[model samples]
Target: MQYFIILTFFLYGLVFGSFFNVVGLRVPTKSLFNPKRSYCDTCERTLTWKELIPVWSFAVQKGRCRGCRQSISPLYPVMELTTGLLFAFTYYLTGFSPELMLGLLLISLIIPVTVSDIVYSRIPNRLLLFFSPFFILYRILYPLSPFYDSFIGAGFAFLLVLLIILLSKGGMGVGDLKYYTLFGFIFGFSHFLLLFFLSTLYGALAGGILMKMKKAGRKTKIPFGPYIGLAALTVFYFGEVIISWYLNLFL
Candidate 1:
């Protein structure tokens, strides 16, 4: 019965992931509700039920549009699978607790923002605005250990990122500033600090590898939101463990 519930979550996640892909691709353009149905970008043909079965559809079509025969972006199936696995894992970890809701909500916020960032190099403000109230309400109902940490973390994240933006002069964008600030509020002070460190570390390593491969130059503008999302998810799942281990080493 436990495994069955996890499987159900995974299935729902796949469906939501597909919608998230649509939301990510459309929300940035302000056309989220225009067509009111999924359509092929290449041929602009409305997709049928069979053509919109999340990851299964992509697999069945061999990653090509049925109408235009155009090769589809792999992002679709990948995000769907990622959401599914994360949903299942979150349920496995938290069962029916309130943390499960937080976990699922976090993934929902992360996936679309990631898709938008990867494709448009932009994180839509509307997306952040939409989720902010939910997070606020969540923290109010289930406050952090040190409830004041939310305020401190938000303040620190704002000032630090703002300073970096000013000093680097376009090194980072405003979207990242907002994103980090929200995450700070979500994770609180101590964990937020670790999240920042891990995000930068991930970005640096990826940038180095891309440069080494001659794929990206020194000035290449790799979107940082995805790294931030990845770091946030990591911190969500394992921040306590990592923090404990590091403190033990120092002790």
Candidate 2:
């Protein structure tokens, strides 16, 4: 049974990873589910089913478009693999419960948001707009209250970033504020503080490292959405353990 569950998770991850590829590519352009076909960005030729089979197809085709033989970015396979691993981890952590479903949905949403923000430095309001109602519905269905927790999370996150932006003379972008507002709803007020701290810590550390290595200029802009996504995933998976660890250290 355990092995079966693992296999199920692996298969589910593979399928969802494929869908995420579409989302990552199309969501930015607002072309998701439009034109009803996948095309080579380079050659503009429609991709056949054989060319679209997620990780395996990339391997078989040697990471080149079939129509134009243009070399496709290996990032596609890497994203698919990363998403697959994340799903597998979520399944292992939550098993076959409501938490598992919620985790999957949250991770799925985060993947595209992360990619979109990293690539375009923008988080489309459409992504959050579409998912916000779902978050509310899930909270209601689960009967998790203070129904206002979601709003509180958004308000707090926005204000916190707003302060940073003001202090730094607009170091933070409005896109980040928008992203975190929706992200806060997913995390809710109960964990918002923790998530914010963790994400800010990670983002600062990462940005500092990049600056030290001279890969990023001191003033270079970096997207914050991925850090927020990472922090949310951490809280979802290990909030209790982390909180306990912190309390033990202090008390």
Query: lDDT (0-100) at residue 72 of candidate 2?
Result: 90
In the predicted model 2, the residue pairs found to clash are none
Question: Candidate 1 on 1-251: residue-level lDDT in tens?
Answer: 99999999999999999989888899999778795577889888988999999899899999999989999999999999999999999999889998998999899999999999999999899899999999999999999988989999999999999999999998899999999999999999999999999999999999999999999999999999999999999999999999999999999
TM-score against native, each model: 0.98, 0.90
**Worst lDDT 10-window in candidate 1:** 30-39
lDDT of 2 by residue, 1-251 (tens): 88788777777787787777678667878778696687888988888888878789999999999878999978678777878888888888888888987888787788888878777877777887787777777776774467777778878888988888788876677777877776677667667788888989999999999999999997788888889889888888988788888889999
- TM-score quality measure for candidate 2: 0.90
**Residue 235 of candidate 2: its Cα lDDT?**
86
- Tell me the whole-model lDDT of each prediction, alpha carbons only: 0.94, 0.81
Question: Which ranges of candidate 1 are over 4 A from the true structure?
Answer: none
Residue 183 lDDT (model 2): 66
**What root-mean-square deviation over C-alphas does model 1 reach?**
0.9
